[model samples]
Target: MYWPNCGKGYLGPGGLDNYGKYFNCTGGVAGYIDRAVFGNHMYKHPPCQKLYENKVYYDPEGILGTLTSILMVYLGVQAGRILNTYVNVRDKVIRWTTWGVVTGLLGGALCTFSRDNGPIPLNKQLWSLSFVLVTSGMAFVVQAFLFMIVDILRKWGGRPFFYPGMNPIILYVGHEIMRDTFPFAWKPTTETHATYLFMNLWGTFLWVAFSIFLYKRNLFLTI
Candidate 1:
């Protein structure tokens, strides 16, 4: 149950908040915080209508969102179980790959892109069934490929990725805290796609660097 558009085009795809004015569907950092915390979502429709209209219809931070996240965690646990149970690398890889393909195809089949309100679009905000299956499938496939390369072949050291993976919560919070700060992000001289892409990549690289630094110091944040 999701509204097509949260007040005056306030919500957009990919978990973006449209800042009450649709200017590229990009939510500012402040806007994201405000909407996430205060729920000051703007809608395309006018005021004074159905009671549901006034309520937070497209709530990704709600209980439903938590349930979807739990489902994702369950998938991760299943993947971990495969690794722990299978002594043979071939068996683990085959199982993971098979599940990946099965879920990916099933999710794709369920998706209908003909209409905006079609059956089960890959909406992260809604955390729809198709979105979960598709992402889980991709995660499984990637995990399998990496397991083969790193654990079996011993090709990669898993430097940056492993560092962040070990301290995901800390790195996530740190990144969010420094997202709009200097060196991590900036108002680019040019507003081109390439410029934005480079800035975003640079920000990510900084977080990876921070994670690696923490790893070198033998420091990890765990709850």
Candidate 2:
């Protein structure tokens, strides 16, 4: 459920109001249940008015959004199951690769259709079903492409990505901690977009180099 009315300027019209309408229109029995439970709660506990007014990105769905996230993970699990199936290597590649392309195209078509004809448009904030499909489709395509390159061709690999992937949590936390600090951030003389871009690129390269150094030492972090 997406609320076009509420955001930087609007409040009171909480997620339930929007999603209830959505459920009424599209949810059927499930929608009725949701409206009965969540809709009632909306009167008691409206969304954080201040958060919506101040925050740049806010979704009233909140924790309930995890329901869709679980769905996304389930789709990934399905993909993994396909990969692990005992099939000929070439046949496996073809199946996964074809599946990726088909899903990607289908997701894209859904997005386009939703944007043109609906009460809801494809929105990342809302984590709309269409957004999930589009992202999942893209993820499948990317994974397939990498698999073909690294596993099938064996000509190239994800060496650059491997180090970062190995210590993703560390890398992410370190970046967040150092985001406002030196090297990662610097006062530019010109203060142009290109200046900021170059700074970011330099910072990224340094992290990559650091990851490679750690990789060479056979150091990895996992949690």
Which digits, one per residue and each the tens of the lDDT, describe model 2 over residues 126-163?
45556677678777777777878898889787888777
C-alpha TM-score for every candidate: 0.64, 0.61
Q: Pick the candidate with the highest lDDT.
A: 1
Clashing pairs in 1: 6-43, 7-42, 7-43, 7-44, 8-43, 8-44
The clash numbers for all candidates, in the given order, read 6, 0
Runs in model 2 lying further than 4 Å from the true structure: 1-64, 113-120, 185-204
Residues 67-108, model 1: lDDT tens digits: 767888898899999989989988999999998998887677
Instruction: Tell me each candidate's RMSD, in Å, in order.
Output: 8.1, 8.1
Candidate 2 residue pairs that clash: none
